[model samples]
Target: MIQMLVTGPKPESVAGRRSIAVLVVILTGQFMTVLDGSIVNVAIAAIRSDLDTGGAALQLIVAGYVIAYAVLLIGGARLGDRFTQRRTFIAGLAAFTLASLACGLAWNEFSLIVFRFGQGVGAAALAPQVMTLIQRTFTGAARARALSIYAAIVSGGLLAGQILGGLIVDADLGGTGWRGVFLVNVPIGIALLMLAPRVLPVTVARTDRTVDGLGLATLTSTVLLLVVPLVLGRELGFPLWSWLCLGAGALGLAVFVLVERAVTRRGRDPLFAPRVLRAPGLLATAVTLLMVMGTFGGWLFVSALHMQSDLGYSALRAGVQFLPMGVTFAAAGLCWQRIPAVAHARMIPFGLVLSAASLGWLAWLSSAGAGIGAAASTAFALFGLGNGLAFSPLMTRALAAVPVTLAADASGLLTTSVQLGTVVGIASIGSVFFELMGTTASSAADAVAVAQLICAGTALVAAASAALAVRRMH
Candidate 1:
């Protein structure tokens, strides 16, 4: 059934009729992108088995999307600033839809991997514009509500993918099975394509904006430095080259900072605003987000694998495992409007403590076993509750200080932190888990214990950082 909301032009406020339409459209895209991230995690083994490919080919499909998505994030925002936000949004939607079709119809494993990367490129153009619209179109209290709604789409995207992947893989959908994962987006994209122009306002850029290609290239190279090692680390026996990639990634990142500072010195808009970085609270929050989301990203990937491979649960069952978290996320997002009015400066630290406690509980569960048993259920729910509160707080606080002129720049910083966190998380902790889990005669028990510990510790460190940043702001 199609869900439709009637909205119009010249609505009294940004969050009035028109903003609703844009939000709906952006949500659909956001859902598709993030869902793709996890939906494939559970199905990787199945995909490899059916396609008769090695783990590397399968991993590229996963890593390819993250890499492409991360690479394109800032550039995507830049495109929105350079061109028409509405045009960029439409073009990105069409490209992503076409790529999804390609992935669904892939005749070979290599084709599937390639198409997924293309889909990610499309997402890069689409995702940033969501924030751009919210920041541009809405204001004051309404803006916070708008931002909260959009944040849910990000989390909803993840849970939806897990559910769909599990259901499709289990259902086999007339033997289409894993292919349904990609096919699901086609209809949503088509709907958005038809409706977008009518509902989304044509917000034009103020002036001629030149893209900082050097910065973009340097940033992309720096990220791949960390991510490549993560997906390939275990398979390659954690060689010296992987270590070099890690070191080089750090160096490239440092170089990227220098390049940005230089660009800002030229009296031009850098890839990210140098001014925004000067806010001590914002910088610390960015660092905390990098660790928080990175650890969570790695945790989701490993959890899906553990559910299917180690526990011998069906894909559908694994999806069910995450249902509680999904439910809480939705509730928390919807209620986020109340946080700023009620919680004030304390919200960030509060959310962090909530998240850290959940991670600690997750550590306990992994130590016991994240199976369908009672012990796992209690701990998982606690973790989900923490996540529900944590996600929006970080996003809200990070961008709170960014002025209207710097909205896009602030958005880019936050998004980049997410990608950087994901790359490092996969490389750092994912490396640790994959390395230990696949080796030794008795690896499963050790891997779970170690991975959970890493997750717990990561969350705690992030919590401490958030607390410190919030306190400083006070």
Candidate 2:
């Protein structure tokens, strides 16, 4: 079956110079999308001060992009299926680039929020295609290597965003302040736009171009209902409307399942094929991804707060603190394929255990009154190494479980799990951190310790799920 999938002429074979260019272009797209997700964090204070933004609006500025991106992702992948990956990718990139410009030039809080949402829309359109392109273009060992690089970019982009955002905001380049963060993408986007058309492979479109209108609507609404509340619930004190949205979102999920099944029965391509969920090992992989990403997200959020708000580190200093972890993560991701294939399944569980242990170490350091010093940094690096070992392999496994024909579906589903996990983690663990951060630095340190333990627990759960996924794969 695997041979049959790769027997055809490779769409754009992952070989030599051309393959390098293709990866560069596509991965750059992925990097930009991921970068924008976290880049605004360090800039938020600058944005609020510059725009005189209110608290609710400030929250929206931060979260609006994620909500839109998560809601539209699966549909975006379906678009790639209908339109061809190359075309959809270019179009999405165009939208994202222009939105970045708009965000940079925004006149007020409202404009920035709206433009940020536009950025999300463009990201939604582009991101899944990155993985889909990799899936379609590469096979066998070559595929694994490409995925490792892809995973590295995902992890690295996140850390880079923090570091770059701080540097940009601190420099206040051309007095742009926080605006520089958005503007930095403009040139990169333009260069990619020019190169993408020439470099990207021409993928064949799906035969069934028929739109799954109901599926799209229901799925989008469900995601929006779930994501918006999670993104804003803590800020708004989890009001009645948030709970109502959660309830409605649950109902919408059930309806969405029914709608997709109906579309499948009618012999039409649904926005998301429900059968993809039933594929061996896919569900377990999704659960593992959700927990893993959630833990990472929660750590990023609380760690930043603890470092800056409590420890009196500047934004630039706080951002720099992540370097050890990011470096190790990139190194581990690039090197993991060196391990023998037979032991690959064990890597996920072992890596997750490492991550959990590292998190526990971090908790111990925090509780023991250790600041962001050498010991804590070592813990961070270890956690990153562990995550690096697991993430790429896990992604490869998830895609491998499904037919190549459903690449877009698998990509979309996996990415959505990751994004949703980030939101869920920040909301839940962030709330705990805030609750515990009472009067003094000691209290805040204690809060961070508890949060680290919670994250450690989450990582262990993810490890169990990953083990289950590996078992199911065989």
Candidate 3:
């Protein structure tokens, strides 16, 4: 059946349909993984109340998944390259589904934390394959359209997680409470698992199948050392050990670079190909993505705090307030392709500038005590539109700059930057927000306004980076 589909006459239509199916299945997986990251946020209080979890344990339950996911992402991408994306994706999905079940059934805080980490490991394995499949399966306009949709899903999932989580916890579906958040993945995963093998195309595995054990170990260690501290430092009050780990992480990064170079010189495949980094415009794109995502992460965190803590909004109400932003973001992502291709390169910086402007508007509104009214909602919508315009095009250009052979490496690098940026933004900007709130003179709205200004500044820097990327590429 697979052979016939490949060699069959006038197979373009069939192939197109298959591509759509593949996108649906894999993107469903992507949504599940991405949603899980933020879905637990609204449920934290419920979980803590039910399981008697402490602050530290609760933090772990949240951060552990992210740490494992970020650390193993590149390795997971390599696995797809080595074992074929279809096979690895299935394995990852299966692992994720089972882990979700375990999380739902966890009896204690420790058990739930462990299961959450397992979910992250599975997600690490699962997430990269979505991009890899998109790269390999589609071409030209189709690829652009697919990427736009992918960006929407990635962005929307974050907001949707919070909204859906609030609804689920408030409704207490079947009296499952917080457990419903994790268990929600079960049916979706099973459906995707059944459909994937039929719809997903089989591709030839890479001939250089050898694993780079040293490169993998060093890279994982470096990321673990770096991400662990960033995720935990605020909760732990930035202990001396956290600082030491960060220093060691910096050194470990140097070691990893040296090891990868040595492996490349030996004609052996490194865990991450260094040549991918040398790809024109890639580094600038990475920097742009880092800053853009940082702004987004910070905005989400601080805005939620302002709404809930200062404005006395419920979780669901706060999540619903973000609906305008999500809608505008998805609309912009999908419609960007309609714009002239000649102007697409310029859109990144334009979008960033627009985002910065909107963020500044938000800061002004917050400071003036405008509250969550039409004006504030409009600003949120504008911010979303700007981000939507920037993100998809940035991703398309970055992937286009690299050779198809290094799709895995490019995917790993881009995705890792996004994840790291989110973690760093939350930690750093969140610290500033907390510190300002603690001051006697500052109100919650004041802290949020300051955070928005910082986010606006980050967006402006990202705009500059995007302009630089355009120059390098052209």
- The Cα local distance difference test for each model comes to 0.75, 0.85, 0.82
How well is each residue in 60-107 modelled by candidate 3, as lDDT tens digits? 776677767777888888888888888989999999999999999999
- Candidate 1, backbone clash total: 0
User: Which runs in model 3 stand beyond 4 Å of their true positions?
Assistant: 1-14, 48-59, 368-370, 439-442
Worst 10 residues of 2 by lDDT: 1-10
User: Which of the numbered candidates is closest to the native, going by highest lDDT?
Assistant: 2
lDDT tens per residue, model 1, 133-249: 777677776777777787677777778878889888888887788888889889989999999888887754545466888899998888788788777867777799998988999
Top-down lDDT ranking: 2, 3, 1
Candidate 2: tens digits of C-alpha lDDT, residues 307-413: 76678787788888988888888988889878898999999889999999999999999988788888899998999999988988888877877767788889988
TM-score of each: 0.91, 0.93, 0.91
In model 3, the clashing pairs are none
Instruction: Order the numbered candidates by TM-score, best leading.
Output: 2, 1, 3
Q: Where is model 1 more than 4 Å wrong at Cα?
A: 1-12, 337-344, 438-442
